[model samples]
Target: MNREFIKKLCEETHACVRILEGPIGTNDRIVLISAKEEPDLEISPAMDAFLRVFKHVNDISYGTGGSTDQIAAYFTACSVWLLVASQQAINLIGKQGSSIKSIQESTDATIRVISGA
Candidate 1:
C-alpha cells in the first residue's frame, strides 16, 4: 500500500476517505472506505464514528476483492466527485437558484469538471 499517497488524499478530502486494516470478521482485509456524512462539516463527526465501528455483521466494501491500487483509485475518484458536488451546491445557493433546471445545470457542471470535458 502507498501509505503516503493515501494519507495525502485523506488530508485533502478532510477524512472523507479512509483505510482500515484488520477489520472484524476478516482475517486480513485492508479496506479503503468512503461514506458521505449528512450535514457535512469540515471535520465530519459521522466519518469519525464510521472509522471506529467495525463488526462481522456489517462489512461495507465498495469494491470487494480488488487490489490496493484499484481501491485507492476508487477512493480518490469518489472524493473528487464529492468535492465537485459540494462546490456545485454552494454555487447554486450563492446564486439563489434551487429550481430543477438549476440543479440539472449544477449536475452537468460537476460531471464536466470530473470528466475533464
Candidate 2:
C-alpha cells in the first residue's frame, strides 16, 4: 500500500514473471534446475497475491454458480488490479526522478481511463 511496499511488490512481480517466462539458454536451464532441486522455492509476496487472484478467478469461472456476468466481473477485477499495480510501480520509480517518463505517463493514462470506466 505504501511506496516501499509497492516498489518491492513490483520487483517481485517482475522476478516472478521472468522466472515463469524462462529466458533462453543456460541461465534459464539453471533456474529451472534450481527450482526443481529446491521444491520450496521462495515465492514473492506479489506472486503469492497473483496466485490467489488466479485461484479465485478459476474457482468462480468453473464453480456451479458460474455465469457470463460473473466471469466478466472477475476479468474486470483482474484488469483493475493490474492497472493499480502498474500505477504503483510507476509512482515508486518516478519518485526517484527516473527517466522512464513515457512509461509513467502511459501507465497513468491507462489507470485513469480504467478508473473512469
TM-score of each: 0.23, 0.23
Clashes of 2: 0
Instruction: State the lDDT of candidate 2 residue by residue for 1-102, as single tens digits.
Output: 234543453464443321233335533211111111233657644444455344443565335232435545655443433433556655645655453455
Give the least accurate 10-residue stretch of model 1, judged by summed lDDT.
49-58
TM-score of 1: 0.23
* Model 1 lDDT, residue 75, Cα: 44
In angstroms, give how far residue 75 of model 2 lies from its true place: 7.6
Model 1 regions more than 4 Å off:
16-27, 32-117
lDDT (Cα) of model 2: 0.41
lDDT of 2 at 26: 38
TM-score of 2: 0.23
